[model samples]
Target: MSLSDAAELLDVHKSTALRILQTLEAARFVRKTGAGTYVFGSGLIELSELTLGSMDLRQHAGGLLRDLQRRTGHTVHLAQLIGDEIIYVDKVDSPAFQAVQLPSRVGHAVSIYASAVGKVILAYLPRQERDRLLSHVVFERYTPTTFADRDSLEVELAGIRQRGWAVDNGEHDSYVMCVAVPVRDSRGQTVAAISVTAIEVVATLAKLEENLPLLFATARDVSAEMGHSA
Candidate 1:
């Protein structure tokens, strides 16, 4: 729609419509045509697809995630690589950790290089896609353990690829620890990750690693539900 049409439909001033269109265009949610009209952009389409796809993934993985949380008595998170960010698509809070709840929630974004879920998903992405995502990030050393630079993060990512999992040893928050494994789709693409997290007081990183076998099994089961084979 043109700015005039949009303003008419929205019952707003043309200046307001132009401002709205400009903001949307910046986010790539709308594109300004050469003719000075507006249309839905690829970003909007991609976000719509991510929403629908993540909904399906959440539904398919819900029970399994809850079961894993129950067995481990720790928080479980399912995060997906959505566009340029890694977003938590689902979470199962541990009943045992009511006193000190982890900060993660569904629909929240995680640091792409600092969190275990983020690293596992990034490690499995194609090199070009990985580079594209990292190119925009301004790394921060959230803790002494964070991979705050590209070179160090690359080494961590390489280890994750070799071992097929990632660990956050309080990288983002000194008290929080996590272990994550990749969740693959039908085409063997790593589209998401499953993580079990806890505070150091509840479970150290080593304690969390003890649950790796179960975590890996849960990831495989969820991946299978996503139509992955072998």
Candidate 2:
């Protein structure tokens, strides 16, 4: 708000409001806009996130992941881009398909170029950061569908950025298929990805694509939980 507006709201003298706002602006608790209005600043957001420390994204997204699993009847995975690797932080299996186990598990690292979740996160990252992450990777043709070279992987990543989502197409394992969407943080960085996975016999890639709307919705909800405004 403007200085006058703030003074009226706080029931203080305009000078008092200006002094208070100046202090907050110095600490970055609030920032003044070009239009002369005050808004919450990055420092305030950082402090809030730090306060919520241990109750991280995994905990915030757990209920949404379970709900997505129930709706899709497929295995759901949440993966985060930690340093140079994409690590599986959480997994939810469909209640009805509990006996049909796949190879994925929480705390496991997934192939960055061969997995849908990994690609989706990579696709939305800044070019320098993405290149840094991929620099250490040695591409391998895990399956016929895998983008086994940096050139081909770049093309696939480009497509994902254009489409706002990604597909595994049995890339890592010929029997497994997945579709993924990016999850953003409050600053609009794609910090994580959420994917739906299923064995070929259970659901083909085409079948999983049918649930893309649900997957995207779940991602948006999870991003909101992560403090993203949109």
The top-ranked prediction according to TM-score is 1
Q: Could you tell me how far off, in angstroms, the CA of residue 95 lies in candidate 1 after the best superposition? A: 2.5
Per-residue accuracy of model 2 over 25-102 as CA lDDT, tens digit each: 976899999999999888788666643542498899999999999999999999987645788889998665556678
Model 2: weakest 10-residue lDDT segment is: 46-55
lDDT of 1 by residue, 43-79 (tens): 8888999889899999999999999999999999999
Cα-based RMSD of the predictions, in order? 2.7, 12.5
Error of 1 at 15 (Å): 11
Q: Please list the residue runs of candidate 1 whose C-alpha ends up more than 4 Å from where it truly belongs after superposition.
A: 3-28, 32-36
| Structure candidate 1, residue pairs in collision | none
Best by the lDDT measure: 1
Local distance difference test, per candidate?
0.94, 0.89
Residue 199 alpha-carbon offset, candidate 1, angstroms: 0.7
Q: What is the lDDT of residue 19 in candidate 2?
A: 97
